[model samples]
Target: MSEAADQHANAHTFIGAIDQGTTSSRFLIFNSLGEVVVTHQLEFKQIYPQSGWHEHDPNDLVNSVTTCIDGAIEAFERQGHSAKDIKAVGITNQRETTLVWDVRTGEPLYNAIVWTDMRSAELVRNLKKRLGASEINQLCGLPLSTYPSGAKLLWLLENVPKVKEAYEQGNLAFGTVDTWLVYKLNGGARANVFVTDPSNASRTLFMNISSLTYDEQLLDFLRIDRKKIHLPEIVQSSHATAYGSLAVSKLRGTPITGCLGDQSAALVGQKGFTPGLAKNTYGTGCFLLYNCGPKPVISKHGLLTTVAFDFGPGKRMYALEGSIAVAGSSVKFLVDNLGFIKSSSAISALAETVEDNGGVCFVTAFSGLFAPYWVDDARGTIFGITAYTQRGHIARATLEATCFQTKAILDAMEKDSGHKLTELRVDGGMCNSDLTMQIQSDLIGIPVNRPAMRETTALGAAIAAGLAVGVWDSFDDVKNVNTEGSTIFKPLVHEKESAVQFARWEKAVQMSKGWLA
Candidate 1:
């Protein structure tokens, strides 16, 4: 046998991670050292049925995931590793992308309502006026907003006839992307493995952050008939058999284990296990999560409290999260919508054409501002535009929008947690740009740490799965998994300059408010 094959045979078995994200589905195979061995990603269609509405066809989500799994497994086998070498699979997905399906037939009653969808704006507004609405954040760690899965579910229940009929008949199965993917990945109606980790459940606003279970008062407030709709059973983030094995893939029958919402998984992947450690993920949207240790710390700022992860009894942790509604998607807008660049990769180069923003500031609140400023009525706005403002300045400002939000979130985290962050670990597509990372570092006045392996989100799922199945015994065993080839960007701009720039951003945000209202 080849030396490499012999080494693979003797080494610990691989772990597979199914990352079901907003824009794509990816299957990645990771080794014990947290190195990605093989990966396959497929971008599925994003459906926009109306203004401010976003969706995904249920089949597209399932089919794309299965295809990626099969493809990644094929690549792994080509490298002389058998599918049997993959001992377990973990799932990390876009949180709060809500879906409803028939329990009997496993057919979707309506398209999956994306977390970014604003169709529930009016519903959330009215819900905020209801009695006891003010107490929801204290109870569930989330305010009444269109971002939660519960809000989206309510919208479907009130608007979609099929969804309403399924709910009334007690045939409705409601879940976020994680639960739906797990149900479908385990053969849908056949095996019927319906469960969700605390991380995902926390985003639904139905689960109590402290108890980590469905709250009756929350149900009453949302007006959801618990008897009429079936919710996924809450489970540990990492468990040996809670998540069923893959039923239809080359790696069929592999035990499925760890699961976390995408942001939480990124935190795990970055090894943000200690309190005050934080990570920012710049995906379709930007999310900054600060680990607040074991107990939940309710945010005095506009941030939301969420489960960081629930590995088991004594390992549960919570996070203070700041969510930004737009990030890398704004770059896509420049490429696809405005034709400022040929593709997203060209954004940095275009922005580099200008030394600075040149007095331009982009709010990029396409869906509305979230976290620290929950301005639901705000719209995307640009300030200080002039003939001197070229595409580069706009591009620079576009990237700055996310950085500015991260700084704002960090400030909020400091106030809420009473601990200042010294550094930030970053991942996702946007973090690849040097200019972007430097901008982020300068804006936050902290070192921006980027791991050589940017696939921390997938690695996080692999870590969870590995932990459950004994591939790794504990967090300490995987602490040094992806520590090599790290790069840290230190702040270059003076703190005063950064503060002045941030002040301008705050002014723009204030001026941009209530545009929709």
Candidate 2:
């Protein structure tokens, strides 16, 4: 064989990951070594029809994913690799973003209700007063809040005319982003491959977390007629033929073998397979997930119990999750809404210009506070602002808001799990800011470890896909993946000082309550 042919024969096989998030859709191809080979990302429009309402055109999602896959495959071919060199693809998406479409036409009945949207607040409030309301969290591992897809679906069925009509006609199909992506990528109505994994299903409040299936009592309590709407079949997170294949693209016919919610994918990407391991992802929203072994731990605090992942029957794990409703989006608010800087990347620079928060503390409850608080009545409140406050002060306070919430979550996790995390594995956009991370480490009083490869979320989906297709035999086989070039930020302030700072944040949180009331 010629040298070119020899090189081609020795080329590495790759796995592609579709990371559909709140703000963007991304496709990343990774080699067996967990190193990124080629990647493409596309940001789509974020629609806010009114205050506390967020929606995404369903077409934007599918189109962005299709474009990203095509773009990444083109780049992969430009290298010495062929499209055939790519094996199965995986999907990780923003959980609880609800959608309903016609079962026959495959057209969306309404815009995708974003996971952070609060239009269902009134519905959720009434749900808490209904019979069997107290059993919801125990059965589904989620509280009756606007955060779950079931509440969103209920709101749509009651409010949207088209959605109501579809439900009454028995043509409504309910799904999170994962199920929709799978259905569309596999030829939509032609293939009709509608399924979701346990991680995604657990967030819907429609699935029984223990049995990993749809619960009758939950449906009855929510007043959803099971016969009226079609829910996606729950499947394993890693499987060979469950998710089907891409129907049109350069990589058409590639099987989708793995699926996870974005935060669960990050945990897997960080190699947090063992109990007591934890990871925090600083995305559009901040999420801290601590592994809690096979069985779920119902939280006494406001933390949520959820399925971490389900590789197969004996390979499932659970997590205690603390979700912050705002993180990187808060930074975006400064850049776009307040014009504090040119872009999000400039936040750390602007914050570093100030020595401290200058007595300002921003409670970022634009929608409401989530996790350990669940204070739906609170609005975004800034405390201690005076004539001395500058843009830098506000910027620092904005960054501190996320850190403070993270600290509260960690404390709650410790109380629920009876285990203190030694260090935190961190990834996502906000983790790129060294100053913010240092502040996080100081307030949390633990090391914040960030890998050089920050796309752990995508890598996680790739890992799941690769596992099903024999790229790696077991979890142990991939232990060394993505373990190099890590930066660890440790505490620099005294313990007393950190406690005082957190106390002030708690005071601000308490004071921020009742604005929505």
TM-score of each: 0.98, 0.98
State the C-alpha lDDT per candidate. 0.93, 0.94
For model 2 the TM-score comes to 0.98
- Which tens-of-lDDT digit does each residue in 325-412 have in candidate 2? 9999999999899898999999999999989999999999998999989988889999998999999999999999999999999999
Off by over 4 Å in 1: 1-12
Give the root-mean-square deviation of each candidate in angstroms.
2.0, 2.4
* Overall local distance difference test of candidate 2: 0.94
Q: Residue-pair clashes per candidate, as listed?
A: 0, 0
Question: What would you estimate as the lDDT of candidate 1?
Answer: 0.93
| Model 1 lDDT tens row, 1-517 | 9978855653556999999999999999998888899999999999999989999998999899999999998898899888998989999999989999999989998899999999999999999999999999999999889999999998998999989998889999999988998898899998899999999999998999999999999999988889999999999999999999888878789989999999999999999987888999999899999999999999999999999999987799999999999999999999999989999998999999999999999999999899989989999999999989899999999999999999999999999988889999999999989999999999899899999999999999999999998888988988888999999999999999999999999999999988884
- Clash number for model 1? 0
